[model samples]
Target: MTLRLVIFDVDGTLVDSQADILASMEAAFAEIGRPAPARTEVLGVVGLSLPGAIARLAGDESDDRLARMVEAYKTSYARLRHQNGAASSPLYDGIRPLLEALHARDDLLLGIATGKSRRGLEALLDTLDLRRFFVTAQCADDHPSKPHPSMLLTCLAETGIDAGRAVMIGDTSFDIDMARAARIRSVGVTWGYHPAPHLSGADRVVEDTAALGRVLDDLLELAT
Candidate 1:
């Protein structure tokens, strides 16, 4: 069997950063003297790149205003991280075990495809001491926002894994659609911002991280 590459989205999938993300978003809007987007609205765009997500949240704001909000978001998010120290977003239950189990498998390769900037992604991975698990990492800095296949294709390229042998695991439709566009499989996780119904585009939807390994086992079998 060819090595199966599993690409994961970072924010809602691996780390439960919803609270911090929401706080930063609200702070950004406040900085611009604009009412913050509703929580559900913000959550809906969790998988998009910062600029794309901000553009959506800004609605009719001018380009300059949107840019300012983006900068504010970055500043606020960084400050929040600094304040929280190591107590930021906690890794989802079973994530470490899942990664270790997968890493133990010679037939599998792990990678990350996230809307997070490279700096943010690296900081989170390093803080969690998880930087060694992934063989490839793709970020918003390297590709277009989610729902585009660029990130997945880039991960496949970097890992020398064909789309047929790859699977994307995330919590949003953007992740599933990206995999679909790339002609690969996707597994949706339910414990994130988006509910399972919203993740119907995924090839399979698992209820939690504990079920992820089983789902991947099934995907790997089908891929071969």
Candidate 2:
């Protein structure tokens, strides 16, 4: 099967932005007088939409209070993100080479499915000069979060590619689950936030960006 498209998840799979995210989230929680979860715990919430993630953090709170907490988080995050001397995030090593190799393939198309808002993704893309590589993007703004298959299906609809000809790549079970639910192939990555076993459902897992690129041919083959 000739793979028609590869949809990537932004934060963990493409760039290491967790430090900045964590810092901003922490400040947000602190300002609301709600303690933030530990960094390791926050990692689990990375791929979910804001409401979903906030629900996980707010636990048994009433919906109205949860809404307030979400607003507080937003207010705090808006103020702290990209401020306070936070370091800029960078792409994982070998990403450039990987993208270059894939871009050279005429049969392949690239897209992004992320929990990030469209504005957030555009900011990162513009900063990294990676906006040109993708032909489509399905962000958190448009639909329900991962494991729901909303974004993956949106990508398929946009690109006119069936699930059988697509592959989803990321570092979390959310990615694998979404692809599985959508009946597409999934590739998981190491050197990202998730634990290895979290990606057990992926068709294959790669340890680094170089290995990820090398395995794309095989992954695409299985998709077809």
**Candidate 2 global lDDT:** 0.82
lDDT by residue (1-224, candidate 1, tens digit) is 57999999988898888888999999879877988889989999999999999998888888888889898999988888778855677889899999999999999999999999998888888888999999999999989998999999999989888999999999998999999999999999998888779999898999877789899998999995
What local distance difference test score does each model get? 0.90, 0.82
Candidate 2: pairs in clash = 1-224
Which residue pairs collide in model 1, if any? none
Candidate 2 lDDT, tens digit per residue, 1-224? 34499999988898888877786667556655778888888888888887788788767877876777667666655555446322355788888778877877889989999988777788778878888899998899887888899899988999899898888999989989999998889999977788999999999999988778778888777665
TM-score of each candidate? 0.97, 0.91
As a whole number from 0 to 100, the lDDT of residue 68 in candidate 1 is 90
